[model samples]
Every structure is written in structure tokens, then in C-alpha cells.
Target chain A: MSITQISVFVESRPGHLTRTLEAFAEAGIQVRGFCAGDTGEYGIVRFIVDRPDAAMALLAERGAAARTSEVLCARLDDRPGALARAMVACAQAGINIVYCYSLAATCIALSVKDIASAEAALADADIDLVDQAELARVLAGATL
Target chain B: MGTPMPAPDQIDFSALPIYLPEVECTSRERIRAIQLAKLIEQVGYTYARVPWYRDQMDALGVTPADIRTLDDVRKLPFTDKSALRETFPFGMFAVPMDEIVEMHASSGTTGKPIVVGYTAADMDVWSECIARLAQMAGVTAADRVQMAFGYGMFTGGFGLHYGIQRIGGMMIPAGAGNTERHIQMIEDYGTTTLIATPSYAMHICEVGEKLGFDWASSTLERGLFGGEPCPPRLKAEIEARMHITCTDNYGLTEVMGPGVSGECLAHRDQQHIAEDHFLWEVVDPATGEPVAEGEMGELVLTPLDKRGIPVLRYRTHDLTRVTTEPCACGRTLARMQKVRSRCDDMLIIRGTNVFPSQVEDVIGRIDELTPHYRIVVDNEGGLDRMTVEVEIKPEAFSDSFEEMSAFAREVAGKLRNVLLVTPVVRLVEPGGIERTLGKAKHVDDRRR
Candidate 1:
């Protein structure tokens, strides 16, 4: 069974995300990674957390609106055109990549039509496929 | 076993029956009269049990005896959502805790879920009223039913589910989403009735087409679309796709779920309320007086038969035009036109009240954009900042971001003239905005 990295949405308003993160803080659920962008009023703070269930409960108890879905944790080389090659391959594979945003400083998040095909193509091109276990380790305070 | 069958006269339905007929033997005017009488009974019942209600009624010099007829409704106090927030959770339940059977709540998208209860009798009344609704929508005992409403703390799924079973129909509790799965049951199990939100049913039709399933030509004959208003075009769209006569329904979770009012296929303009179980009042938004017949105003509701806890003169915040005229379908119960707009969803942008539905009406008329859009509200200095972000068709893109922004500004300019609200228009790419597994909420109200 493959565990999926979930982007728990946290609001950016005052005390909006405090209790949510506090739940994880108390549960000792370390965040592996996160990316947040704001439209002045609201922010979509997506995160890769180590404790998915605990994190869900923490946010849920606080009534924070969040969704846990099976998102692929794809890894690519931090080099020029590395992202392009993957996008081109996916496009060639008839997979439409809708809304590509940043997951981290190095990694980019793409909501592809076929995550499995995107991963397969990236692997075929010799890119490192970051599994959930690896992401958990990285998010669990492990050095890159 | 057949030889020992008793006569129909031996049947005992004084207890809870699968379907307790609402308002066939009892006339609607009689029901309203009974409702006024019940309102008095409820006030007295609450005065002894519910202190806040007693205090409020007492403060108005309005005792239970003061309420006698429907005209006396003005003497009774009005209740709003703010009062619910003040007394939330269980401040309103009339019966003691052990008597309550179930608890359902409002979405509380803004705040905490305002909880309401169902007594054993409440459970009975809700089902029987909805059973009458299903009968009106053409669902008979032989039909296999598929309900695609979201069930949880919310009430739509459970409300319709109980109604289907009450009408002696075979029920597949296909609680919303998983489109291909619902289609499989519709095909293999031969389900005929579909009860769900209009948008969700349309989504199902889209998926069935993509997956090569035949729900359109299948045995499905009746559809009950509710939770939100469906425009005439979308109503026609769903009907064509499902090959079923799509009927519109109206209700609020606060008003005890989905069977408040429903449109029969004969006409979509007016929906008859279950006046026997619930009382309907259309009050002018400003004056709070009853609107004359065929006039526009806000809808106020009072549950007549409810016992666990009930609201009296509860303002629904839904704006509509009402009429008591006889419909093509022979029911004399008062009917209301589908809501014009939610007063709360009205945006006061640049001195004009811009309703999302008005913008949606325009967008639905235009073929340029997708059905999804967001009104991102922020604080513009001391003023309210309004951003109408619309998704451009994937095939339609400007040469530059500035060009796209200019196009959006032109659209915004048109909207400003139409709605009298100047909005900062931002043209976004297709499919970046959020989508809910449930209700499609477009208004992002900032400043809490």
C-alpha cells in the first residue's frame, strides 16, 4: 500500500491557523514540507505532514477546512529544464498538467491528469521518484 | 398465509405509519389555522421549558394566549440566525434531552454549526411530509430509488433517504459523489428515481457520458433536484441528459432539510410548501409586514407540527415573490417563486448590491467562461475590496497578462454598470479555483 502526502489547507488569518498547527504541535506531528500563497484575504497553505491522521484530527477539531487526497511526491533535479522535460513528457503522454505551483524551493507541484503516468515518465527519464516514506523521513526533520 | 388475511378495516395506523398523509383530509387554510393554534401551544410549551423564549415572549407582552390566528403572527417576535448563534447547540430544543431522537446541523460555513433536533414524532412528521412530496414527484412504491445527497451532520441525504423508505420504495443509499459507482447501480440495479443537488446530477451526467454509461435512456424517470436553485437553462440541461423530468426543490438545513418546498414537473416557477407541517410567511424585507399576494419579499417560516424544538417567524434571508393562485397542478397551498437571491450573499461593492446570481446569470448566458468563478472580498483600505476572478476558457487566452487583465476589466466594467458595483476583475486560467465535494461556494467573505 502506498501512503499519500496530503496538503492540509490552513487559513492565514489571525488565529485561523494557530489552533490547527497547535494540534500538530501538541501531537508532535512534524511537517515534512509546505507552500503557502496569499490573495490578501485568504491563503492556501498546503503542507506535507508526517502524521496525516493526527494532523487531520487536529485541524478537524479546530474546524479548519482541509482535505486529504492521494497526491504524488515527485522528485526532480534542481537544474534548468528539469521541470520542462517532465512537463513535455507528460504532455506527450496525453496527460494535461493543470495548475503547476511550487511545493518547495526546489520541487514544483503539478496537478496532472495522470499522476501515475507522470511519475512513470519521470522515472523513465531517470528522475528520482520520491515515495511517501521518503517524504515522511524528509518532513520528520531529516536533512536533505 | 393468504387465506388468513384480515380486512383493511383491521389496520391500526394511530401509531407511526410509513406514510402519514399531510393535508389531504385537512385543508391548507385549516392547517394554517391549526398552525396558529399550535404556535400558541408551542409558546406556552416553551415558556415552561425554554427560558429565553419565555423572556422574549414575556418582554413583548405576548403570552401564549395572545397567538390565536395567522393574523396574530405579527404580535409574535421574529427570530433570526443571530438569535440561533446566541442560544446555539440546544437552547431551543423543547423536549428534555432523552426525548430527542437525532441531531442535524447547518453547514456553519461562517461559524459553528447551529444544531437542531428531531424527536421520535419529529422523525415521523419529516418523513410523512417528504413522502407526500415524493408521491407528488411521481415516485411510487414499486420504484427503486437512488439518493445522491451528502449525509452527515447535514440533513439532505437523511431527509430524502427516510422519505424514499417511507413511501415503500427500495432505497440505495448512494450518498453523494463516486459518480461511476452511482451509474453502475443505476444500470445494474435498475434504479428509477434520483434525488440529489442539480449541480451534482449534472456532474453525474457528464461522468456517465465520459464513462459510456446509459443513465439517459435507462429506467430513470423522476429526478428531485434541490439544495440550491437551478436556473432554467441548467434545469433543461439536466433533463436532457438524464432523460427524466427534472424537478427543483428548496429547503434549508435550518428549516429541517430538503422537503420544505418542491416544484412539480408541470411548472417550475412556483413551489408549494408543506403548509400542514410548516407554515409559510412572506414579509417585506424592510417593513416586516406580509407582502400582498403576488408581491416580492423575504420568506419567514414557522414549523407548526414540530415538537422537539421549532422556530417561529424565522427569517430565511431568501428573497422571493409569492402567490396563492391555483397552479396547473390542483393544490391551493401557497407557492413561492424560486429565490431571486440570498440577502447575505449580496455584495455591497462600490455602493451597489452585486449578487453572485446576477453575475452567474450573465455568465450562464455568455459562452465565454466556465461555470466556476470566485468573488474574492478583501478590505480595500477603509473600503471593501471586491475582486471578481473568472476562469477564462482554456482555449481562450490573451497574448499577454496585461491584455487578459484588460479584457477582464472590460467585463468587470460591464458588470459594474449592470450591478452598480465596481469590481477589480482578475482573469484566471481554467481549473485553478477551489471545488467542494458538496456545495459550490463562490463567495469568499473576508473580515469574518
Candidate 2:
């Protein structure tokens, strides 16, 4: 199962992230989990939001360059080596995890090249996978 | 007799009067005869006055008598910038200091500046040559010409100034920079013609836009651009934005500056050379052999009647094609294509030759990319790597990393198709690259 993630292109400068968050705040879009990476000249900010479609529409209205992509969310054991086990399962199944980040205490989000194979491999490894609806439900209940 | 004539603004530029019709509109045979006689005279004149010329000719065992036909011009020794540097200031002057009336030198960013002295007669010839070029580009005596080219040691400003004076036009003499003042003068004086590099003209348009100055509303109608290569795309942008017809002229300080060849309004693609004053030849940069007809090669020029500082077969290092076919503008002089790049600007990346102009042409063709770019070459692990940093149009930015990555790949693919070597294309933010008022620097080689 996969959930939609929003990636925003921003120039690498002061107040850019703050401005992006302000735009989301003004639009009443709740960002569940977010991470940013830089490439000297510009940065890419990826967000797991409550309403991705609305956020994307808002970003478009603001003339911001952004895109939505599917990412797999996995509910892991609240213990050490939880991510390692999931990574090992994907690696053994020859699934490429493009990027991964922690969403909550025992919930992690991963962007993989082969989402179907990655979801199947994680399910086979006895790990629970979260879809879009389940991820919204968890984010609603969790204090963030 | 019943049909109405077009307004002055709507008149066809091709119908404009040739400044020196006797020479510019002459027969090719007569042009060749004039070139042969001038070449013979120039060779002997240089041999007698300048020791550098005599020594170079003696070493090759070639005498002035050897140059009988125009084809024999190949036998003369080629004078390059290094030769001028060896002679330094005033050493290459064929005339005495009292005869020299004016002097100009290149910016010489690399080392010592190469000086050029113009006698009173030489100044008159320079003015006439520029006037002929100005007329070819549709500059009329009634138009108010504003010069944005700097008027100092650089030849651009003074060359155009003298030419505009000769044409009896109202000269604004605005000089370079102070963009706001230039804009004000253009509006207040109703300037109809602008003398500037294409890049500066583009910059002025941008600044004008920022200041709420409407370029289309302004009286600017013609642009005489030189000092750097103006690609057709950039020229079109300036013309559309400023509502002006942009013309490109070619020149170098080593030869007579800004008077070698210029584009007429009728045939905007090629520039008509002042063949009466200078003999032009296109030869392969490597072997110095003539290229096939209408093929690109290094431009070699020999100033025929220059008395103060005479040069024979001076290698311009600029690469362009030349065609002797008569122009539609009624000029029988040879026409050379706009010089897009120089031989010295060629970069050997990973054993493959690449020119910045090629990269520029590729970038200009893509809709989402801007012409502003920098070619950075660095050696890593004893292997050369070229990175083309291109600015993306603000409207073309995509928030998706995948889409942007694909766009970069597409640009790189196009570049590889042209250059035969793949380069890492980095999409930069709009206005990320620096702009210049003078010649734009395109290469950044860190391998050295």
C-alpha cells in the first residue's frame, strides 16, 4: 500500500522553509511528517500531509513548483533494529528504497522504486503496511 | 501614380542609400582588382616601414613582389595577437608619432594592452567605414542615435560616435552604463537608434521593465550590436522586447575596430564586409588552409590602405562562413555569417572538442531554458568533466524533483547530440548567473 507525498522545490536560502510552512499553515494543511535535503543551490522538501491533493492545488495557485508521488508507509515494532529488519527484507527481495524517514515512534515512510514488490516483501516479512486511509487515521490520532 | 507611398517608418530598409555606392555596389571583378592592387601596395608598405613585417617576410623568403594575385595572400606571414604583444605599444606603427592623431588599445585582460595608432587620414577612413556600416543597418541622418558603447580606450564607443557624426545624425553620446540615465535620455530625446552589445541591450530592456519603462513605446527602432557574439535567439528577444531591428557588426582592435563587416537590415543573417578597405579570407585554424566555400573557419583579415599601423593577413581567430554572393541590399561585397565563437574559446573536454557557442545554441533552442549559461570544466581522477550550468526560466520551474531531473537529462541529451560528449547539465535558478555590460565570459576551466 502507498500514500501520496508532496515534494516542493525551493531555493536554498533563509526563510524559504518558514515561508513554505507558512503557506501550508495559511491553507490549513496539516503536515504529518517532513524532511528537507539540499544541493547547494536549491533544496527539495518532501512532506507527508493530511490533504495532499488540496496542498498540491494550493501550491499550484501560489505558483510553486511541486509534485506528488506515492510512498510506502510501514508500521514497525517499537524497538531497536526495526528499520534494519524492514530494509533487509526489501534488499533481499531486490527492492530499492530510494529514501526512508521516521514518521512516528514506530511508523516509517519509504520511497522505493518498486512499491508493489517492496510492499509485498515487507508484508511477507511479517511487518504491517499502512495505506493512505490508515496513514490519515493514525496521523489524526497521534500527537504531532 | 494613384498608389499611395508607404510612410517613412514603414519603408523597406533594403531601399536605403549605400554610404559609398561606388565601392560597396561595385562589380566582383573590380572588387578583386582593387583587392589585388591594395594587397600588393600594403605588403610593400609594411615591408619598408615596419621591421617586424620585413623580418617575418625575409624569414619566409617571400617578397612584396610575390603578391600578384589575391590568391597569393596565403604566402604572407600571419600576424596574430602575440605578434602585436611582442611589438607592444607603438612599435608596430608604420608612421611617425607626429603623423599619428589618435590612439586606442584593447582591454588586454590577459597581459599588456596592444596599442593602435590612427593617423588623421586613418581616422577619416575609420569614420567612413563605420558610416557605411551604419547606413547598411538603416541608420538615417534624421534619426537620433544614442551610443551605449563606452567611449574610451575601447574602440566601440568612438568608432560608432565618429560614424554617427559622419552620417549627420543627432548623436546622444550617452556612453555606457547608468541604465536609468540611458532610459531617461531614450525617452526624453526620442532616441531612434542604439549602439550597444546585444547583452547590454537586453539588460537595458530588463531594467526598463523593472522601472516601468515601456520599451515598445520608446522611439528606439534600430540596434547596432557588436563586441560579442549575438545569437539569433538573443537578437530576436531584444527585437521583440524593445521593438527594434537588431544588427550585428564584427571587428577587432588588431584590425580596424567595428568596421570589418556588419549585417544589413534586409539580410539579417550575414554581415557585408567592407571589402574595399579590407581583404577577408576564411582558413582552417589548424592547418591554415582554406575551407570549402560557405564553410566555417577562422577569419583572416588584411587592412588594405591603413597608413598608421599596417597589418597583412592578421588572424582574427573568429570562426564564421563567408559567401561572395551578392546581397539583396544591392551590395556586391562579400558577406560573412555572424561570428558565434572564437577558435581560442574551443574546449577539449574528454578528448572531444566543444565550443561554448554550441552549448549556447542548444540552450537557446529549448523553451524552458535561458541563454545565460556557464561551461565549467574540471579534471577529476585525470579525466575531464564538463558541467553546463544553465539558468531556468522562472515559468519553467517544476516542483517535482523527478521532472526537473528529466528536464536536465533532456538538455544534456541535446547537448550530447551536438557536442558528441555528454555533459552534466545543472539547472540553476533564474538570474543565478552573472550578467555583463561588455563581453560575456562563458568558460570556467578549473583543470589548469
| Whole-model lDDT values for every prediction | 0.70, 0.85
Kindly report the docking quality category of candidate 2: incorrect
Question: Number of backbone collisions per candidate, in order?
Answer: 1, 2
lDDT (Cα, 0-100) at B12 in candidate 1: 30
| Highest-scoring model, DockQ | 2
Best by TM-score: 2
Off by over 4 Å in 1: A1-144, B1-28, B345-448
Residues A48-124 of candidate 2 have per-residue lDDT tens digits of: 88889998898777656567889999999878898899999999999887788878547888998788989999999
DockQ of each: 0.02, 0.21
**Any idea what lDDT model 2 has?**
0.85
Q: Estimate each model's TM-score.
A: 0.58, 0.71
Each prediction's RMSD to truth? 16.6, 7.0
